[model samples]
Target chain A: MKTIFIGAGNVAWHLAMLFFKNKNVQITHIWSRNKENAELLKDKLDKNIEIYHSLDSLDFSKTDADLAILSIADGAFESVLSKLILPKNCILAHTSGAQPMEILKLANYNSIKNIGVFYPLQTFSKAKEVDFSSIPFCIEANNKEIEEKLTSLANQFSQKVFQVSSKDRSILHVAAVFVCNFSNYLWTISETILKEKNLPFDMMKPLLEETLQKALEINPSNAQTGPAIRNDEKVIEKHLNMIEEMNLNSNFSRIYKLMTESIQQK
Target chain B: MKTIFIGAGNVAWHLAMLFFKNKNVQITHIWSRNKENAELLKDKLDKNIEIYHSLDSLDFSKTDADLAILSIADGAFESVLSKLILPKNCILAHTSGAQPMEILKLANYNSIKNIGVFYPLQTFSKAKEVDFSSIPFCIEANNKEIEEKLTSLANQFSQKVFQVSSKDRSILHVAAVFVCNFSNYLWTISETILKEKNLPFDMMKPLLEETLQKALEINPSNAQTGPAIRNDEKVIEKHLNMIEEMNLNSNFSRIYKLMTESIQQK
Candidate 1:
């Protein structure tokens, strides 16, 4: 199958690379707002692939493909779609867990027919190597035929694939924010707390990794341990006092109290 | 070296097993208020380890050892320490990250000469198999000789060992709360969000694991992603509205906003 990729960010970079290596897939073109990013992505893969600077000036006929994958940022979807023109029957899919396939349908009101979502539930970094086969791919489309095609395509990249509705995908996105983004922010807090004490952040590495592994081994509720879960008011008070004494953000105390309450309620 | 394990809780169970396996060490006695817990711990390992129901009832003459590790809860530390009777030179230590070595020092003010902290920084579940060799063991003592002996014992079970003061260990404990307890609570919230949507929590495993791996690969601040870091007020607003619409915990929305603002500030 022939595929045209849009965007050159982390998601696009990884997805494009995965598709480029597939024997049955051909990346006809890669487009990004910054020509330099597009060139960088192109330069990382087969140099023969076409590259475009803007979706508005693209010659769809010259780079026409069976599929067009939109891997741009969630906020840029509508604006980017406003400038796009695609050949008839070209399947349109996005890699955003937060966006629905209807956004693509609405954007292409009369010009597009087949639109879908191909959300991969994994965080990507351009500098790291991602084993795509292990990541879960959530695919959805307006109809079964398109969904089946998308599912087959996704299956080529990953062993774990599921058909999730737009509503469910949005819900997943919120959860993803908690597990990935919010938990990560907690790590930053951990680093900050250690930094102030002149303690090595490396000291927490084994504990951090073990905690994550513990969650997978059993229910997180069962795995939970600390002053909050134990409801040790003395330790909790001591921590809060220390936070205040250290002149840290008030949010730390707020989060600590709320989480402790939640764990106690559970 | 010989040791006496006080409290047959999760930490004590794994630790006793480690000591029980070491050719150079002998677990002289295992004490727990609940005889059943002590017996269970004993049954899991060598059958010869003595079991006791209370520190006050423990016959220290028959079970005297070079080291006494109080693995009981922080709340019970003082009460338990008040009941203990040991040989003059027997070193006393605790397996708590929050409690200071001074508690032991104060508890045994007239009788005890050596007090220290031997805190293994990992969440333990009795049912799970824990490989202690990789876990970080933070050791601290009132004197250099006691500190060296405790460090030597800790090194037997773990390669990652550090000599941290009671003050610094307390600081490390607070940071650990953010990384382990608070982060696990975030996982609980993620599970709740998915459960309300009738979605399987297993679907999030890959994303959860990848997020943790990313944090370890680079600084969490640099690894941060999602609408909050991007300062995409639109997506953030949409997520908050969705949380409100679902009638989930108000705390969820509160946490979402606070975390978003915190990430943006950084």
Candidate 2:
């Protein structure tokens, strides 16, 4: 199996690396807006690798790929899809959990016959390394052929693979935002709170690890503690008084109230 | 120092075991509304250990030499604080992040000038064992003498101790809700999404653990990922369509947008 990667961000870079590691698979081409990033894969792998700075310069038929994989931002997927000119039978795949395959079935998919999604349901950072085997890849397709090909590709990189419906993937992405992105936002808030107190976040890390570790061992509903669930109005009142020491007002207050109300629902 | 543990929930149970393990301290009493829970602690420790459903059963003045530490829920803390009868000049403390020392003021002092907090900032589940040594215990007091006494008590359980202001501890508790409780809520949502998709959440656990592990090594702002932060509207639209299929309304939808907007702000 041969793959041509699009984009050079965290997912692109990591996915590209995984493809390079597979003995049977060949990573034939990579294209990114930043030439530096585009060459990153070419420089790290075999010297004969093809690098394209823009989709316009590429001859899709000559790229010699079984698939053209999109690993760019969600907003950018359409632009690349609109401009791509691939062989009639080549598979066009994007690694986005939130994007459904119907988006690829537009009137513009002139030459490409097979289109699908190869979304990985996890957060990825460029500086940090990802173990592809550990990440869940959500694969989807408009037809069985594309689905089978994408499933095979996904299996090469990870043992955890699923042919999730677009509806399920969309809901999964929403839930992913809550679990991965929004949760990180909460961590950001925690770090800021600790910083204002002249307290290092390191002190809270072990507590943070234990918090996650506990949830892994028990249901989150069972793991819940703190003023909100306990309905410690006195303590909640005290904490609010202290937070007023800061000059900022944000949706944070609304979030706290809403979540508290939610926790209290039971 | 000989001590009396005033509750036997997750926190108290884990703590009693730790204190019992330490050669320096003895847990003389464990109070629990659940007699079985109290008996379980007694079963695991010295047979002479006293189990009480209420503080009224123990004449606190003659009970122990060092301290009477309360580790119940917040609403229960003040009631026990008001009712406890203790030795003159003995340290009386409660393990709560948000409660102020003033609750133990002139009423329950027993002529003992010492009163404080020995709060471990983490979530605890009864079924899951916790490594108390790594958990950070925040200590606050009415005065330096109480601070010293509470610090010694905290040191018996955890190596990391901080002399935090009640203001800081309260803020820390608020922050703890974000990092611990809110994080677990995210996991719950993830599990819900997976259940809807007929996918195993076990597939996502390794990634979830990796997400948390990376969080400890890097700031969450830098660790941010997903379609929203990447500003991938096509992907977002696709996910939205999927959500409609699942019949989930706009509550989580608004949260998705709100959190995405917040992530972009970072």
Candidate with maximal TM-score: 1
Q: Compute the lDDT of residue A194 as modeled in candidate 2.
A: 75
Displacement of the residue B193 alpha carbon in candidate 1, Å: 2.0
Separately for all candidates shown, the number of backbone clashes (residues 3 or more apart, or on different chains) is 0, 4
lDDT string for model 2 (A129-186, tens) is 8777867888898799889988997898888888888877766666666667777777
The recovered share of true contacts, given per candidate in order, is 0.73, 0.65
TM-scores of all predicted structures: 0.94, 0.90
The TM-score between candidate 1 and the true structure equals 0.94
Candidate 2 chain B: 10-residue stretch with minimal lDDT = B248-257
Residue A152, model 1: Cα distance from true site in angstroms: 1.4
Task: State the lDDT at B121 in candidate 2.
Answer: 83
